[model samples]
Target: MKAESETKNQKADSTELDQSSFGLSALNFKLKIGFDGKRAANNLTGLGNYSRSLIEHLADQFPEHEYLVYAPKVKSARQIDAFFEKENIKLKLPKSGPFLWRALNILKDLTQDECQIFHGLSHEIPLAIQHTRIKSIVTIHDLIFLRFPQYYKLIDRKLYEWKSKSACKRADKIIAISEKTKEDIINLYGINPEKIEVIYQSCDDSFKTAFPKEKLSRIKATYKLPDKYLLNVGTIEERKNLKLVVQALKEVNEEYKLVVIGKQTAYFNSIEKEIEKLGLKNRVLFLKNIPFTDLPGIYQMANVFVYPSFYEGFGIPIIEALYSGVPVVAATGSCLEEAGGPNSLYVSPNDATGLAKAINQIIENPQLQKEMKEKGLEFVQKFNSSVVTQQLMNCYLSL
Candidate 1:
């Protein structure tokens, strides 16, 4: 706690350093941006991961320009400073309004901050904000609300649909995480293709290295993972289509287990029932809320990583598994193919028999695994954080 406090104080002092000369440098044209980081703890999903990764990389790479992180009620000044405590980073106080407190607060702060550009990492943007001068960028991760509307609750579907459409319409620039998603925005949302850019997300650097055998062993012991288990990483939600994966697993009973790592959602009862019906309660394990630091070890322990989600913005875990040197088997449709490229074995998303066969084929063949790993590594280079950061910086410049 004391260490965290000291770090917070250091950040407070650093931000006090001169930001008056911000617009002078070419890097300053990179822009001072705001994002909804307030969704860190409670409602965390893919958006939270996207927000955290983008903010950390932006602050580290662009120290000359200013970054104003907007959050609700500053709870732990330590957590805020740890993420955005650099010389150019500043934290604005939360504002109150009719929408959720954090949303309302961020909406209010845009009027006050001397930012050149603003980014809504999530789908929603402050439609009421008097954006008379500053340019805005909103990242529409995917148009899942339109594509998979039945998966979401009615209220959530309506809210996300309204906000997503409004944000795309209002922003000066839009970022789609994949080309598939970019097409979805242009087709489903009727946004112009020229206005949007496709920037893929990268796996963490830690995943690229071979985790120490001892570390892998420790994680394996903790989770009781099989000697050669298949891995799936994501929130256990309805849209993730884990029931299909479970069905696939039942047909291919081997020495391996299907180990799932993610938080279980409220609507996952049907999946649970499916697992019970398949008699896979012992074979399929759901390990929820594992820390990011621990994920590389888990990935390293797996023989093959599988992500059979029906849809995605960009499947970070697919490449993450690839980088960890685990062979990947993903569904043919959606962004998994984009992430996995030619290397990954892709089966139809809803085909339990095909998915089962793919998993078994990878298990039986060692050479296939080696080929997939090498091809995955080659494809992963394009989406490196450094490369993606430059692309993002260029987008900011364009804005």
Candidate 2:
């Protein structure tokens, strides 16, 4: 109890110091931006991908400015070391500190490093930094907990709402990954639409490059993948709506198998039960812990990539499928259309008949499949790193 009180007191002192420092005017010199690198260093999910891509592109395109990535600890250092090869980019890992002191320490380090602009890659910024002179930008991926409160516990929902609302209210700029998310912020928190910028995310470059047929065949043999299959990649959770895909497969009526790759949760038990109930044990395959290098080949080999997610800020897997030259069939009700483009087929999330019909349409028509793949490749060029990085640069320059 005493330790907790001391930590709170120290945080209060830091907040006071931050308020005093706010009077200093903005620096009139070269740009030095700092990023909250916790997600980039440890998380291999959507936020990590976004952080690494943004950092790599910015450093490569605009090497004149200094880029600093601050993290409390790095668990995936080897995975992200390539981004730090540039001379202008630096990774800042602070010494180990108490759990409660992390926020305060990050603020002190940012001030000491003299960062002109600080961008939070996820939906958080240190409270002390917001009161200081440094310009703040936060990337809000979604308001999922608020939108679907039943999926979250009461405590978590309150905490997420508080933190997100605070960041949106305090930060100088907000980067919403999709227009849907931006509208949610406006309607829920009443944040000005002018303050939010919608920036779409792109997939990794590995998906765009082609692999030799022999190499792809070798990977396929190693995984023992079927000759024809439908692929779906994402975390196995209830909101992702994977059961709908299973139900849709019952109507495929062909030799096509269903290949699912994702980390499983308790919700997966329900999906397994559904599969067993339908007697699809031999037709359904669940793959876990797939290497990052092999993912492109897996995607390239698929006949069609299906995403049955009910909601998302933006769908990265759909973009990845397009980059790998595979046609996509994703669900409606979110910003998936922005990622999959008009050529990709869409169906209602729970409409197994509609989804199955769309899938069979693409599978039976060779010309339609070819047209969708070609158009997807053409559409994905707009999300190339050069284009998206320039938009992010404009955000920093505006500040």
Candidate 3:
């Protein structure tokens, strides 16, 4: 009923928003491809990771083609700098200020570079892209701003809707990160279902690597992580439902602490007040500056991973946890089920007590933890790099 109302509201206001090539030997053409790599250079959150990982995997799997990463100028190179330095992948930068150039003038550069296909890694393509001969594809991550308007500023919401609608109308095909997002796009923008493709996003390959016991201990010591902690990773905001997990912590074992790592937002002040009110000041810990390389080791050390977000295009932290061999407990609504698979536990985002029970159910049973770890690893194989990258290549080739 809530989703229905949200869909109706989005309609009244009206707006918008695979895989690999089969055989390398079969597809004989080598073409130039461009990506909206601005986030690849500057942002450090989900979108940044998505842009960087997708480009790297595609380059590795389909080495025959040229990969062009079009990013605005950055002050300094980031950790993913080495990944982009591959032989076939070249970084293209803007000559002027990033904003207008990225939105408008980048099309001129795209034509000059002779890009056969230009992909918007985030939620937009160049506004005038359809005028050119190059094919375009845009990946729509989610419609949270429209679905839950209370969390976004008025001007920001209007801008996002306008940009997403324009990009959807202009692009040759649309890629949705999850089926949930696909549904939102169709419901809100009235786009045809045939034009959209759902390609699941995977975690960084680092998460799948098993760190040595010595290194796990070192990372644990360096981060000052508690011996027993419940992990949650995502931006601190109203939509992520971090307070629900904090409330759930009040009922779990006293030895267990809740560890959170994400970019902070103004919503954190309410969380601090909630913690103080519940007398859990020492029970919650926040790590702000965690290095990207060390994050998987941190995940491997947790007793359990919890992601009680109210909504998501896809809850990526769940996949990271599953790959890290940790048990997962996530909220029931949204696309978390798609990420956690069949064995991991789930509770409603509104049910703090239910969430506590689910966490304790796994923590108190060692055999269950082993089973979940084994089953989760087996399940997440569907999102392996080979399978996902192949699907992505197919999408580009189709266009």
Better of 1 and 3 by lDDT: 3
**lDDT tens string, model 3, 1-399?**
353355445433321112223333425768899998888877666677688889888888778889998888643555667766798888889755577888888988888999999999988999778988999999999999998999989999999999998898889999998999999999999999999999998888899989999998899888889999999998999999999999999999999999999989999999999999999999898998898889999899999999999999888899999999999999887899998999999999999999999999999999999999998988887677666776687777777
Better of 1 and 2 by TM-score: 2
Clashing pairs in 1: 95-105
The total number of steric clashes, by the backbone 3 Å criterion, in model 3 comes to 7
How does each model score on TM-score? 0.86, 0.90, 0.90
Q: Identify the runs in model 1 with alpha carbons over 4 angstroms from their true place.
A: 1-30, 40-45, 75-81, 95-108, 128-131
The reply for model 2, stretches above 4 Å from the true place, is 1-29, 95-102
lDDT of each: 0.76, 0.86, 0.87
160 Cα displacement, candidate 2 (Å): 1.6
Could you tell me the TM-score of candidate 1?
Answer: 0.86
lDDT of 2 at 33: 97
RMSD per candidate (Å) reads 7.6, 11.1, 8.3
Query: Residue-pair clashes per candidate, as listed?
Result: 1, 0, 7
